[model samples]
Target chain A: MKLSKWALALGIFTSVALLAGCGSGSSNSSDGVTTVKVAWRATGKGDSMYRIYSKKWIADFEKKNPKIKISLQPINASEGDYFSKLDLAMKSADTTPDIVNEDTFILPADAKAGYLEPLDSYVAKWSDWDKFTAALKKGSQGSDGKQYGIPGTTDARGIWTDLVVTKKAGLAADWAPKSWADILTAAKKIKQTQPNVIPFAMGVSTTNGESVSMQTFEQLLYGTGETLYNEKTKKWNVNSKGILATLNFINQIYNKDKTGPSLSVVMSSNYGSTIFQDRIPKNQVGMAMDGIWNTGNWSKDGAAPIANMTKVLAFNLMPTEKGQKPGYVTMAGGWSWALPKNSKNKKAAWTVMKAMNTKQLAVTRALQEGTLTVRDDAAKDPEYLKKPFIKEATQALQNAHFRPKNDLYPKVSIAIQQMVESVAAGRKSPSDAAAKYATDVKGIVGDSNTDTQK
Target chain B: MDASNVIKNKPHKTQQQKTERRLSVWLMLPSMILLLIFFLTPMILTVVFSLTNLSLTGEAASSLHFIGFQNYLQMFKDPALATSIWNTIVFVLFSAVIGQCFFGFLIAFMMRGKNKTFRRIIGLIIIAAWVTPEVVVGFCWVAFLGDNGTLNMLAHNLLGMKPVAWLYTFPMVSIIIANVWRGTAFSMMVFQTALDDIPQEVEEAAVMDGATRWQLVTRITIPMVKGTIATNIMLVTLQTLGVFSLIYTMTGGGPENATSTLPVFMYKQAFVSYQLGYGTAISLVLLLIGALASLLYMKILKVKI
Candidate 1:
């Protein structure tokens, strides 16, 4: 009886192990046709249209290239999860997708990791490459001066204002603030007159991620007559007067004057959604330092419809500290298509990328996703120019600044976000936060890679 | 002539004993191999990675360098690590030690004299939380506790009070409650089974000896179930120490590292920051803590050998 029981247990264990092994069975065909795997972030409120466009692009590419099969791998996740999942997949050759839709900010780090293939050779041969302007072309190049990705869609950030609130504050209907003081004055007036409505919306917490850094902090920092990175020295400007001034400005808005939203609202994870989707359309918020894609939440096809949004809303270039050199400040960020180095079907993947990068697809994607076009031709397209807000946003791009393209940029950006949050929460004075930020950033990116600005 | 026959028989008897010992080892081989593959191998690999500079991307991706003790040294300097360790301890203490064990035992005691139908209904109700996926539980709590969530709406309408962002104001407490809700079911069932197994004669003798209900429970019932309590606490503490999905979904370790427990910290370091070596070191610390908890529980229970 003991022998029979042992045999039965061992038999069951072996069968279970065999079944588990069978569960991972994948069909690998040695057929003539090449299958190119493409992965992209297709989950979110705004990504549905992009998903449809991507599918159509894949279908068109497969049709044009009969020998290559396109597999659409839509990542149903948030931005953070998508990047981690893609990063994991790219670590191994067996699971890495051939073509990946990468955020432009991550290009330098991803490329340095040897996950990306330099596409300079392909871009040189492709005639349509010239359709992208110098700035757009620069967005795709890595720190090593190698073009490793194809820019698809980019967006610029600026000041968005509700004309109704501006008028109520005795500011002009066409309220274009020429300097930092002017913006503050307008906000103060709005607070005094319209006590119930929040005068401005700006994110600063770690939960806000790049939204706080890019839309609010960077805009303010750049306007204070300094840049975060010294381009010539290739070192981060950690201890800069510009950064301190920006922190003070945040402290002013959030803690001192209380013109911005309450700490509870700003600290929440849904601060962005609450600001744009609920507050802006409902006219509960006045001025906001935000991206150009706010209209996507309130358009006729949007999740919520706001009647006559264009008539009620207006936007302008976020002004410099005193409207000094370069006059106004805006920041542009976007996504790109990168070819992974581990991909087997490089040629087929390039074909798919090329098919997706056409002017028509770019324009359609920009229109549906409510992003600024990276291609010069697509930006000037009549259909795209029909939207007045897009025209102003395109104009705002003339003074736009890109983030510091470095491997340690992500860590540095988080430090900046923390600094802003500390000031916003009244936990630290601007000088204190600035000092701590300098120390923290120097710790993250070695001291040798950073410089103290005079 | 008799001695020579005995020596020859002894050699045959020794041969039979040797064969039986060899068969016993063979019978244990499968379990030993499975443990080695599933648990021991990964643990050894984590230790190896912890001694090096290994990251998912950037410089550490293509090249790995052995920087012995460097990852652990850096972890000591990381301010977030201190906060994460404190948060982890608080989580385990509240969620497992006090919340689950005390509340679970309380409910078990309340239902001790109940009928079968009442017991089954209460069991199903509590087990519902235990059986629900962590992610679903997290989402449910988020909806019920968010700023504009169900609780806040109800409070606003009923009390004429301001809405509270419970997760923001008290992230640790909120997560502890959610965890207790999910885990108390296990403790409840275990304690109930243990209570039932106690001999009826001992309890009846105590009752006949003029012992009050409270005295009987304190002096007799708790002492009898001390072993089960220790086991339940050990299991729940270890399980709660590694809760990532529920906490991550609820708060994402923010407003500003307020809710970043060890597992969340490890995840951010390993996946988000791509620092695999540093994250592995944190994982080893977590494993050591779990091992220490088990040992401490065993010692407290005075379980010999």
Candidate 2:
């Protein structure tokens, strides 16, 4: 009886002590100075770059506005964790940061949650707002037709080819496939010659999140003349020939031809490193459906310098299904700067935003981070044009497609990732995966909000 | 005069006993109040949240509505949830019950009457993994099991074999090994302490009666420390069921949801999907499973309360 009573008492005491420390205090304005809480997702080497940039930006802002202090918080985590952490922090007024670097894909959802303050009024006052590309501005606009963020950079997705492997497969060094069949023919030949190398690499699993959607699945799905979302109907498109054909494409590469990387590698969380850091450099991968930033990793200033990258590696727009009208398709995704709804120092936060989202900064970031320019002025900058892949990707941006910026797109994107993984793993057939995807999408957006492509 | 004094003393004595009982109840008040405010309150809130359509966003958090078992009903239809439940069971069975308790006990049993220096070294090594922070352990295992990791390198150089992605091909088994590697120290230490308490005379008598090694362990040593075995299993199983960061860091429940356990699933639903209501409902299921496992151990051990 004594032991039971003691255990109960100990349990209760420990729990209460934990709860008593739950609430955290937010920054407050004092006599003359206001503190602005600035937060961004910085993982791996990006943390140091963000830190350096933020320090300079903060110092510049504080010099101009002496009464305001910048409290920069760098969340060192993966992109997925960063999103969830930012969302959780924004749920409460006390924990919310003043300014955050929001993924453009999540801008609509965050705005819907009332975590983000619409920047329409601020953008209307800003002089350089008109300098941003219309497509980028649209990417940051919420479903309610309100501007929620200022986009930083947009990345164009395409196929990265190793000329060495292509030449070995008896393909021309400047080979650019006009259709899906042409790409497959090359992959087949590479498999026959190299035997050990992965003929093609694409993220086909839930492990890589948006990478699987933009880099692989969407690149293919858009070429089929169908999209995940129907802008005209404002409903997600599922159960369509386009989606099944996309899945079949994945199935053929993974199962029939076995030219793709092992499904297990595709499903591994760190598989991106294997493709970028190992396979491509070793010329062990023939072709890869990846972003333009992939080549940026091999930039002159980067950790690895593939000497004469322009000679060894080449890129082309992902071709449409039958090389039909437009002939090629690409999808654009990017990050944005957003203000939290409960920011204590909104004016100061706006100053930070303006400081960070400048044409000069855009040019610098494009060169430094290997990101495509989001602003028209930055795209024309000589420094930006000099970059290896930037010139080519900027031209492809005209043919680029943007994902649906609705609040449900994040969940829908995850469902697409799951569908790709299931089919790639041979756990489900293309038809079964498509069916499951349709059901998952319908459940998320409601059946009334979705439509069959037919 | 003597009779009147005796009656007055008896009444005073009874009053003193009543006051002592009242004091005992007062001593328990702070604990009861703490339990009501902290433990009971959050559990009740979870139950309430499980019945609603609350989410991180999308008109749900602003105006949550009661859906009455809708989330629970949907759980049954989710194939991924079923896979998570199965993975969690496999993880607990392998990592906790069989791996930690049985193997740890065997190690402890073998170490009896062994060299003190050797025993201390082995104990310290095992305990080191447990004492290290969970995230560090996770990263260590990733490096050890990665395609280009230590295990693969050793296999390539030593055995003349090709490198393999250990975490991908055997996601469940890999994590189980990691959990066991990190957690078996607790069971081993506990069982070793229990073994020390066993009288040496009884074991010597058993050996004199011609009892073999296997028979001695099964018939004598195990029966003697049955209580420790039961308690160790209960503790280890509960701890393993709640593992999140280690698995999340290593695999993030990937290789196609093959390593997603209950906690990982709950986190994905609650935080990733932002479906707080559904995630809480799944958490309650995890809670129930933990309670059930504890109860099973208690019943088998004949442990009361």
Candidate 3:
């Protein structure tokens, strides 16, 4: 009787294990065609740039490659959530998509963790690989000195101003600020003119996620002409004049001047959409120091779909502090097509990826997503530059700074975000926050991997 | 009755009993396996992960190792954890215990002898909130409480007041009110059912003694339903402790972690910061607090019996 019960228990355990295995079993080739799953952001109140491009590109890729069937897995989330979900999915063989739209900044860490497949061998043979910009090509390189992805889109940050709001505030509608002070003066004027409307809005809260790091903090930090990472010494610039100045700048707008959105609004995780979809269209915000991609929202088929977005808004270059060398400043980042290490159809995914990155599709994608093409040929294409907003946003690329794509950037970014958040909330003064940031970075990456600067 | 116990005289009954027992074992095997695999495995894994230096990504992800009580120790040093715990306590104290229980009982008491139509209308409104999805409730509250939201607009028009950022300035107060509004329905229904079970004569006798309304409530009714109130408080407190989406939507634990509760703090650490071990350690602390509350409530309930 004991033996029978034990045998039955064993049988049940095996059956349950088999049952669980089949539930999440990977769907490999069955009907003589390999299925390649592609993931990209598509759903949200914001722009459906990927959705527009994916619908057409999927058809084109499948048509070109007869033996490969492409499956589209559209993750509808913010940048932070999208990548986090991707990381979760990539941890398992069954959940990982064959081709994922990865942020270039995260590729290094994902590659280092053995989550993504190195794509160097595949890219080397591709004839069009040479057409990708060198800096952008560097974005796809992993910490192990291997290529993990191919850049699909690129973007630069600048000021997105509402002409109506600026003109009403007695500032020139197409004004170009020469220095940091010029921007502040404009902000003050706008604030003096319109007491109810937020004069200058930039993300400075934890809820804003990487946006606080890339768009607001980096834009200001890079403009100070001091970098967070010293590429020369290979150590993080923990305590620096640039960081302190950036924090003080945030303190100025948010705390001292009270020109930015109220802390409540800035503290919202969903305020990115709120700014573009609600505030800007409603003329509640005068200006935003943000990315080039938001202009897509005002396109005819875009989310907000303003009738004359270009006429109403200006995309001016973010100028450096004190009008230093390389007088304007901008930060560049974009998405890339990467394959997970556990992806079953690596070659099939590459084939689909190559098809997706063709010159024609790249131009269409650039137009749809309000991003610059990573491909040199596509960047030069007239169709990509036909949009006036894209043409103007392209100017920011000349003086742009890409984030240090490495193993520690992600952790370091959190510290930088906290530093900015503290100042934005008036919880810490600029110097104290910078000092605390130095301590936090030392805690994260060790004092050996860090340096202080004036 | 078992075949062997009731009809032991038959020789074939013993064999038949063995076959019946085997069949029952075969039937229960699936659920037993499922419970062992699904429920017990994750519980065990969470305990293991909490004791290790596990991260969601980067170097530690691929090579997880045991780190003892380091994560738990880190919690003591993390000011955010203390802030979140205090927020959770304040939230549970004000929103669940005081606000929901008080308003729920008050509303139920007020509607005791009302007309059927009035009762049905009030009942539907309360139940509607309960039936609605948490995310939808979150969005509704956001629209109602946001700076450019309905409340501000209404106040600006009606009271001629300058627009006040209700959610920003009073993040905790806003979420507390929203939680009380959303959660009172459950407490109301519990109290209502308990109040209904009370014999009408219990209250009538107190009235016959010339007791005032408040005195009648304090002396006779409350003492009678003390056990039910204990059970209700325990249930609501647990429910309110787990509330993530509502506060997440409204405040996102922002304005410098002013409104971050335990669950929200866990989410930020686990998902946002991608510190899996640290997040799990925090969750274990949360579970400990919950278990203690349950024990305390159970003791109160036992005292009444």
Stretches > 4 Å off in candidate 3? A1-22, A43-57, A281-284, A306-310, A389-394, B1-29, B300-305
TM-score of each: 0.91, 0.90, 0.92
Q: Kindly report which residue stretches of model 2 are placed more than 4 angstroms away from their true locations once superposed.
A: A1-23, A46-54, A262-265, A277-279, B1-38, B157-160
- Per residue, candidate 2 scores C-alpha lDDT tens digits across B1-305 of 69889998998888767766655565666667668878899999999999999887655655779999999998988988899999999999999999999889988988898999999998899899999988899999988987678898999999988878787778889999999999888999999999999999998999999999899888999999988888889999999999998998888887668899999999988877778999999999999999999999898889664
CAPRI category for model 2:
acceptable
Candidate 1 off by > 4 Å: A1-29, A45-57, A168-170, A188-196, A262-265, A305-307, A425-429, B1-34
TM of chain B, each: 0.91, 0.92, 0.90
Residue-pair clash count for candidate 1: 0
**Ordered list by lDDT, greatest first:** 2, 3, 1
By DockQ, rank the candidates, best first.
1, 3, 2
Docking class of 3: acceptable
TM-score of 3: 0.92
Poorest 10 consecutive residues of model 2 chain B by lDDT?
A: B20-29
Pick out the ten consecutive residues of candidate 3 chain B with the lowest summed lDDT. B296-305
Winning candidate number (DockQ): 1
